[model samples]
Target: MKAWLILLGAMGACAMLTLAYQAGEGVAEHRCEVARAVAKDAARSEAERRDGESAAGTAQLHDNLGTQLPAMEAEAHAATERIRTIYVEAPVSGVCTRPDGVQAELDAARARANAAAARGL
Candidate 1:
């Protein structure tokens, strides 16, 4: 009878230990889930902040362009008017020769374009 009682007590202790281990596992899983949710929230918040900053920068660029456009348009109109006033001499013969300074002007324009490209503009 004593041996039977000892065996039953051992079995009960093992059952209790099993229950405790299962409860610990459940708690660990819950903590991992909570951590994952917090990390996701942090990542979402960072993305929203970056998007807001980008939008502000875009708005500022548009404002700057809006302020500058009228001056640029006026300059273009003046240049066009000057071009209309210039008089070119007629060719002496039916055959036309290339105009003087055309090549130099083309070279200068090309240099300016290259400089702008090098400056990333």
Candidate 2:
């Protein structure tokens, strides 16, 4: 009877661990989706807008995104951060690190690209 009880307890513990891992993965994925969309879209929108504008007419518009892109990127990054997943138990995971960097880089790149486009690049 004692051995049976021990066996049952061990099995329960294993199941719980597996469930926790799966739950963490699922939650992390949701976060990644939002973050990826935000960072990527900022870049994507800028690209589309640049494409819509002639190289000789977009420089000013490129500079203008500064007012708008940050909010979207911040929202996206926040979504990513909602995941409780952690690497090495850090407060922030590596999965989210790229999105954080991407927001700034994408915004800056879009600005340059737009400016260059306006200049007829």
Candidate 3:
């Protein structure tokens, strides 16, 4: 009779231990799931912040280009007009010979070209 009581007590202890272990596993799993969700939320917020900053930078670049383009265009137009005026005012001559200054300019341009070619430009 005493041996039977001892065997029953041992079985009861084992049952309690099994139940405790299962409850501990369940709590650990729930905590892990909560941690994963928090991490995902943090990553999403960071990505959104970086995207917002990138969008703002792009907008700023567009605004700068919009303000500067008309000024650049006007300068280019003025340069073109100056070049046209120079060509129009020059006298037309029957002689094929170029003036001394023009010849010097041509020589300099040829030298620059030769130098650039030497450098494989």
What are the lDDT scores of the predictions, listed in order?
0.85, 0.78, 0.88
Q: Where in model 1 is the C-alpha error above 4 Å?
A: 69-96, 99-121
Model 2 over residues 62-115: C-alpha lDDT tens digits?
766777789889988876666523431243555546545665676688689879
Candidate 1 vs candidate 3: the TM-score winner is 3
Expressed as tens digits, the lDDT of each residue in 1-121 for candidate 1 is 9999999999999999999999999999999999999999999999999999999999998999899998999999998767644422233354655478865776688789889999999
Which residue pairs clash in candidate 2? 55-117, 55-118, 58-118
Clashes of each: 0, 3, 0
Total clashes, candidate 2? 3
Badly placed stretches (over 4 Å) of model 2 are: 55-121
TM-score against native, each model = 0.54, 0.42, 0.55
Those runs of model 3 whose alpha carbons end farther than 4 Å from true positions after fitting are 69-121
Per-model root-mean-square deviation over C-alphas: 10.2, 31.8, 8.4
Query: What 10-residue stretch in candidate 3 is worst by lDDT?
Result: 88-97
